[model samples]
Each structure stands twice: as C-alpha cells, then as structure tokens.
Target: MINKMQILSLTALGNLDAYIRYANSWPMLSAEEEKLLAERLYYNGDLDAAKTLILSHLRFVIHISRNYSGYGLPQADLIQEGNIGLMKSIRRFNPEVGVRLVSFAVHWIKSEIHEYVLRNWRIVKVATTKSQRKLFFNLRKTKQRLGWFNENELRIVAQELGVCSEDVREMECRMSAQDISFNPFPDDESSDRKLTTVMTHLRDNTSDFANGVEEDNWEMHATNKLTNALRILDKRSRHIIRARWLNENNKITLQEIANGYGISAERVRQLEKNAMKKLRTAIEA
Candidate 1:
C-alpha cells in the first residue's frame, strides 16, 4: 500500500497522463478493504485513510474538470476547485451507503467547477437569479446554430425555463456581449484575437482633431450656462448650493449644514429644497 506522503507528492507533481496512469494501475479495492478504510477515517479519524481516499479520486476530478474547459477558464484552476469538491465528498462518504465513492463525488466535483466558471467568465456576472442560471447553462443546448435569438425562439426558451420573455432577452444580451479592452497594445493584431489596439486607432489625426473641437465647444456651452445660473441666485443661496453640491466630496446632511451655519436644521432643509427647485427652473428656462 502507498503511504500518504507518496500519494500527495504524486498528485502535486504528477502530469495529467501520469495521474491517469496511476488511477488505472490501482486495482479496485474489495468491499471489505473499502469499508475498513472508510471506518478508520470516519470513526477513528485516521488521516492516512482520508489521504488514500482522496488520492484515488484525484483523477476523477481531472476528468470532470475537462468537460468545463469550453467556458475559457484555466484547466488547472478548474481541477483545483474540483479537488476541493472531491475532498468534501470523501469527508462525508459512507461505506454503508452501498455506492462507490466515485458515484457520490461526481456531483460535488461538477458543482464546484460550475461555480468557478460562472464567476470568472465575465466581469459583471452573467447569471444572478435562479431562472437565469438555468437558462445560461441550457440555452446553448437549445440553440441549433450560432445566431441571434428570434422572437419565436425567445418565447420557446422563456416557456421552457418558466421565465418571462423580457428576462430571456436581457439574459441573451448579457451572454452575447464580449468584454472590450480599455487601453489595448499596438502589436496585438493577431488573426486569433478579437481586441483592437486602442493606441493605434485613437492616435489618428482626424479623430483627435474632431474630438478636440467637440470637447471645447461643449465646455464653453456648459461654462456659460453655469455662469448664467449663478447670476440668478442671491449670494447666500449660491454659496450654500456650491458648497453642498459642487465640492469634490460634495453631499452633506441638512443637520451638518445647519450646525455649520448656526441655524435650525429644519430651516436648513427648507432652504436646500427651495434652492434645488430654483435651480431646476433656472436650468429649464
């Protein structure tokens, strides 16, 4: 029988091929051998027995993680999460249940990998609600080809998943959108990659010139409107609004402003409300 240290060393350093070979080489234990090991771990709290159970199932986790590689997560990371699941399953395994450890561990392994994929696949999560999660996994299976969903297809998916049609449309939009790079590099023009080089395109003379003119005009218009609005307000009202709303860390409670000005809090609140209403009417006019 292999020792615990030897088994862990093998799992840590072993390649996928080597681990598969090791799993295949180990003869399936007799029912008595399995029962003794499980009892030792569960009843006697034997670490060695637990290690043996986990080592034997590492290859099973690897096999399960491979099925989820289509989601673009690293295979090694997926396998690591699956191994956590396998350990949990081993910790809870019952020899009296009459089923092999592999059968019980499959659920645990896949559950861990599924969570990892959903979390790391996008910046904003693709699935929030339970119905959306079900649709996210099953929508690929329902679609025959890679095109946008038509109204008929949308209705079918919504009905099958027991969600509204608009929910289906929202989820589909989230799923179809790809993440865009903010400041891409110049040498990334490979045929295999989708992101464009931001520096190369943004440095174009025509685009820069046009954007500069548009930005200057907008700034001038905004400055004129602000100046006009300030002229319409009395000095104290203008000062209150500016300090409260225009400062960098701008928002203060009415009580805070009241304390600062040595006035009643209710009076401060009334002033603030009147100031906001006046600003709105001024902006509209």
Candidate 2:
C-alpha cells in the first residue's frame, strides 16, 4: 500500500525547483529513529511509519535522480520514479537486517531510474541485450571527449566493459542515431521545390500474411520451450524462480522465501542463481 504523503509529493513535482527545496526541508532521521520506523512498518504493517520513512528519504531520491540528467528527461519525472522505488524498498525493509536503510534503498532507487531512462531515451529503443544496455550507459562517460572513438579507444572501452569491441561499436552507433518521424509534413514551398514527405515512399508490411504466421509460430515455440525447461527443475528451485521473478505484480524477497523453507537468505539466492543457469542452458539447447 502506498502512502498518501507520496501522492501529495507527486502534485508538487510540476515545479521542480520548488519541489527540490520542499524535499530538502524535511529533516533527516537519525539511525535509531529510522530503525524503529522500519521495524514498525515491517513487523506491524504501519502506514504512518511508512509515510515517515518516505518523507525523510525524499532528498536522497533527488540526489540520485540528478545523476541521470544527461538522458534529456525531465528532472521531476526522474524524481517521481525514484520516489516509487524508495516506497518499494521501504515496503520490503527488514530492520533485523544489518545494513542501514539508505544503503539498502540505493539499489531500488537506481533500478527505477534506469528503467525510466531506457524506456524514454529513444523511440526505437537503443539497448535490448544485457551487454548493450551496460555499454549504452558507460560508453558516454568512458569516451575521452566529443567525436567518434578511434580503434585504440574502442579496444580500451571494450576491455573496461568486459564486452567485445564490436558490441561497443554497435552501441555507439545506436546512441548516435536520431529518431525520425515515419510521415513528416511538407513545407509550404514543397511542390515547386520538388520536396516530398516520407509517407509518399513508405511501404506497409503489416498485410504480409506469411510474416505474421511465422511470428506467431516462433512465439508459441518459445513458450513451449520455457514450460518444458521449468518442468525439469527440482520443485524447490522452480518455486523460488517463479516467486522471485515470474510473479511480476508481487515478487517475493529472498528473506521471505527463506523463512518459509527454513534456510538462510543467502542459500535461497544461490538456488535462484543455479536454477536460472540451468534454465538458460535448457532453453538455448
């Protein structure tokens, strides 16, 4: 359940400078105060405690959101997404855990911001693969300066990112490309100047019956392969993977699943990792 105070914060986000100032005005909670509030929320499901925790952490969200300003997205929207992540982290926080809330919340905060950047960065979506996504963010900072990379610089970047040079080159090209409208309006003088709109030469491929049938067959084949792969796993590993990842609306934490099975959270994590490895091998086969 989301706190009402966060909903109020969303309204103030329209004026970003004022929102930042408002967020900074909230006092930071001391270690004892934070732990007590976390315990209340975690153990008792206290919504008031949740509200307090979120209000205090608003400034931290702003600080993290500022780091992604290069993506050309609005600052207010980034803060709003980071706020959602903060709320999610609070919901799952365990006071018994040794780490501080700020330390634990950083991962959730950055994760939400990363998703926002990728979704809005381009119309065509630049980075789909895992390696390409890593390259997309780091490539800009790793480059020496403006302009395209030479061969030596490309090799250096690939080594840094643990990807082949070709991957880095491809990501660089994708990042440099700009989005164009499929059908653009012509200028007032176009007829005399012989200027033509893009729609004039555009071809529609949606009516190709063979291509549509092929796509449907591929999707059905992938789904069947995944079902078969899951069937091969041990019961416990299969449940862990489904609970943690497959249930998108409500993903269970490792600690929660561990408590049910009488094991440590670390053990649950290990099982999840191994299960994913096996599933990948099966699917690829």
Candidate 3:
C-alpha cells in the first residue's frame, strides 16, 4: 500500500530518474469502472464520481498537452488549461453519447489547450480569421522540416489544409517571424530588425511633422513628470490617481475605489487631493 501510494505521488515526477516511474504508476480505469463512474455522476451529480473520473484520466490530459509542446508554452500551464476543459466536458457530458468519457473529453481538452497556446504563443496575434487560426495550428504538421516551404509545397499544404496557397504562405511568414522589441535601443546596429519594432518611429503621414515633434516632446515631458510625481505617492494613492485620471476607459469613481480597498469615500478623496497637488507641482517644474 505504501509503495502504491508513493507511486501515485506526483512529487517523484519532478526528478528525471523517477519521472518514468511516476508516469508508469498512474492508475487506469477498466471499461466497467469508467462506465460506472460516468453513470454515477450523470445520474446522481456525484462529486466523488467526478473526481475519480478526472483523476483517472489526468494522464490523458498530460498526453494531449504534450502534443502542443511545439508552441513553446509552459507544459504546466497547458496541463492546467486542459484540466479546465476536461472539467467542462465532464459537466456537460451525456453518457448516452455512446462514446467513452475519454473520447468525448479529448476535443474539449485539446480545445482549451489550443486556445491557451494561440493566446500566448506570440506577442502579437498571428491569426484573427477562422481559416487563419485553423492553419496556424495545422500547417506546422504539414511541413516536413524547419525551413520555409517552396511554392509547390505551399500549394500542397494549402490543398491538404483546405486553405488558399496565399494563406499558407502568409501564416508561414507569420510563424517564421519573431517578436522584436517595441522600443529598441538606439545603439542597435541592425536597422532592419530595429524597424520591425513598433511605434519607435511611428508617424502620422497626414499630420505635420514639426508640430507633431513639438507635441510629442511636450507629452513625453509631461508624462515623465507625472510618473515621477506618482512615485512619491504610496501604492494606493498611485492606483487611485491612475484609476481616476490616467485611465481613459472605464475611469473609476471615488466611491468605487473606496469600496474596493474597504475604505470610506472621503478618505479616498483626501488621497486624491494630495496626489493631484503633487502632480501639478511636478508638472509646473
């Protein structure tokens, strides 16, 4: 019993030597046991039955999560997301679907993990349209190697993936592209890579360049002063200032801020007073 209990413990998996041993120790449910548990939860809303179903299939979640390892996301976070999908599947699952829970849960598990990967896999989103998103996941599997696909290969991938060749090429370009710093340092020698960074040289082509420069300079000075002023204030006061003044959308009210921090509105007002005074003084200087 002690050996079995030790085998089930996930702690052993943290060590490379014992990782396979722990994975091998995971429990598998027989066909009868799986059906019984699913039925118990489906009929009685039995929480224990749900727990057993989830625990017994955790290895499946791990397996599905590993398939997405190419996305460069943390393995633990992928597993966590898959667990959420598994729970959602368990909640909505009907035993009458004529498939085992594992079969039904695979879609949900992969769906959740896929969403997580798509969201965090790149600094800027790679895909917005449905077809682009689908290609984003499947295109890598179609390719044979690390290098870019030729025109012929792109056509073949597009056909297999049911997208236009242009789409495969576009997504391929996106995947090949790497995230760059938005504000690259002035000392960087590579101008091409530096230009890839956003907003550092962003200019409104329609706007006057000279006045734009003047306005931009003023804004930068004002922002720096405001930031310095905010630093002098405490954490709560800084948050109150940003929530009240800095935030353009969904600006918070004194009462709302007070409610959040468990203080009276009048106390919040006093803090706002001191913060604004400091800002005005700093900005004037």
Candidate 4:
C-alpha cells in the first residue's frame, strides 16, 4: 500500500506494453514504509515522500485497471484513470486513520474506472439515474447467457441487485441496443443491409414529386370540367358564377353582381344557387 503522489519519468502511455512493464516494475511499499511516507507528506509536505508513495503503488493501479477490461475500452485509458484515483486517495489519506492505503484507495480507483466505462461503453449513455447506473455496472456480471433475460432470470437479477424488475429490463434493453449511423456510407459493403439511414429513404412530405403531379392533374381535370360546365350556362349566369366563386382576390358579392346586372340581390342569390347545382351535377357526371 502507498499513499503519496509522485511525478514518474513516464511521459506518455502511447506504448502500452512498455508503460505496463514500467508500472509493474515498482515494488509494493511495506506498511512501515507507507506510514513514514504518509507522515512526511502530511506533516512536512515533503514532495519526495509523495513521489515514493506514488511510484511504489503504480502496480496497484494496474491490477485494479485489469478488472474493467470487459467494457471494451482501451486498457491503457483505464489504467490512466485508476492512477488518477490513486493519486486522489493519496491526497486525502491520513496516517492516523489506521487503514491500509490499498484498502482506502480501492473505492476511489473503482469509482474513476466506473465513470470511464459509463462514458465510453456506448455512444449514447446507457445509465442516467443512480439506480440505472448501479444496475448497469452490476447487471453485466449477473447476466450468464448471451441473449435477453427470461422472467426468472430478470426477477433473480432484480432481487440480487435490490432493484425493481422494470429497471433491470430497461437497462438490459439499453445495453443491447446498438447505435447506428444517421447517414450510411455509400461505399460501405454492408450499407445495403443497413438501410436505416435518414438520407436514403426518409419521406419528404413537403417535396413529393408523385404527389405533386397527381394533385396538378386532379386540379387540371376539375378546371376542365368547371370550364365545360360554365359553357353550358347562359352568358349572364357564367359571369355571375365567375364573379361570385372563381375570383380569388376581389370576389364580387351578390349585391355587387346584382348592381352590375341591374337585378335585385335576391335574384343574384337564386341564380348562384341554380348555377352551383348545375356545376355540381356536371362535375359528378
């Protein structure tokens, strides 16, 4: 156990094997040695004491990092995170506490690694709430089979984790869901199988070429019917129909049309009713 931070000669972890070898080369600190270092750092703020403590405990960080390899994240990154947690514990460790540095550092080390796994395990975060987050970390280990859980398995897992079955099921579904690309690559060999892309086939209701053509054809056919129907009416009736119904911006009212035709407004209204009935019949036919 060690309880101090030291700036090691290690600059980067680009060469993972070399970094691991270097980290493991440091021997573990004995109990007396750790106590002396902790006292020196705590009382006198001795930087050298901190250095020795951190160097001697580098292997512990490595040992703890190996457990998180199941998350599919890079091992070097996990080791780096665990190393941070170890340093954090060293900063807060008190020699008077009577606990081994390794024992005290374990929680901090696992905490950093857990955060890393949650962040990088999936593109979308699988865990949000505290219960879901707890279930997420423990659920993977509880699961024995490869596929989804049966009711028995789900209930067992929920009971073991002390959570509701619904939470377990939700976390399981989240874990099993795959993140997909929004726009698939055209050159990809498997693009055909992954046809679930927005760019490929999402319906654009605002710009439907087939729908636009159909609508235009229907409008033209209706216009031709109305024009033929108007030709069947007398000239006065056609004028009255156009003024009353077809003119969009300046629709002539019944009284206005009546004034233009030198007839009562009621006469114009009767003519409009008769003309609309005829147009409806002709269009239907």
What TM-score, over all chains together, does every model reach?
0.55, 0.66, 0.60, 0.62
lDDT of 1 by residue, 133-228 (tens): 777877755654535778987887878878898987887888889877765544566656666565556555456777899999999988787778
Q: Is candidate 1 or 3 superior in TM-score? A: 3
**lDDT, candidates in the order shown:** 0.76, 0.86, 0.78, 0.82
Off by over 4 Å in 3: 1-24, 186-198, 206-285
Q: Between 3 and 4, whose TM-score is larger?
A: 4
Residues 66-112 of candidate 4: C-alpha lDDT, one tens digit per residue: 87788888887887788888888888889999988999999899888
- Rank order (by lDDT, best first): 2, 4, 3, 1
> Candidate 2, residues 1-285: lDDT per residue as tens digits?
566455546634467777777778889999999999999889888888888888899899999988898888988888888888888898888999878898999989988888888999999999877667777878867763635888988887888888899988888989889999864656666466665677788788768988889999999999899899999899999999999988999999999999999999999999999999999999999
The CA root-mean-square deviation of candidate 2, after full C-alpha superposition on the true structure, stands at: 17.1
Candidates 2 and 3 compared: the better one by TM-score is 2
Summarize candidate 3's per-residue lDDT along 1-285 as a digit string, tens digits.
012222234432465335434444658998788888888888988888887777677778878888888877777677768877888888888887778889999999988887888889988999877777788888877664535787777777778888798888888889889988866656567555533446756877897979989999999988788788788788998999999988999898899999999999999999999888987887787
Candidate 3: TM-score? Answer: 0.60
Model 2 residue runs over 4 Å out of place are: 8-14, 144-147, 186-285
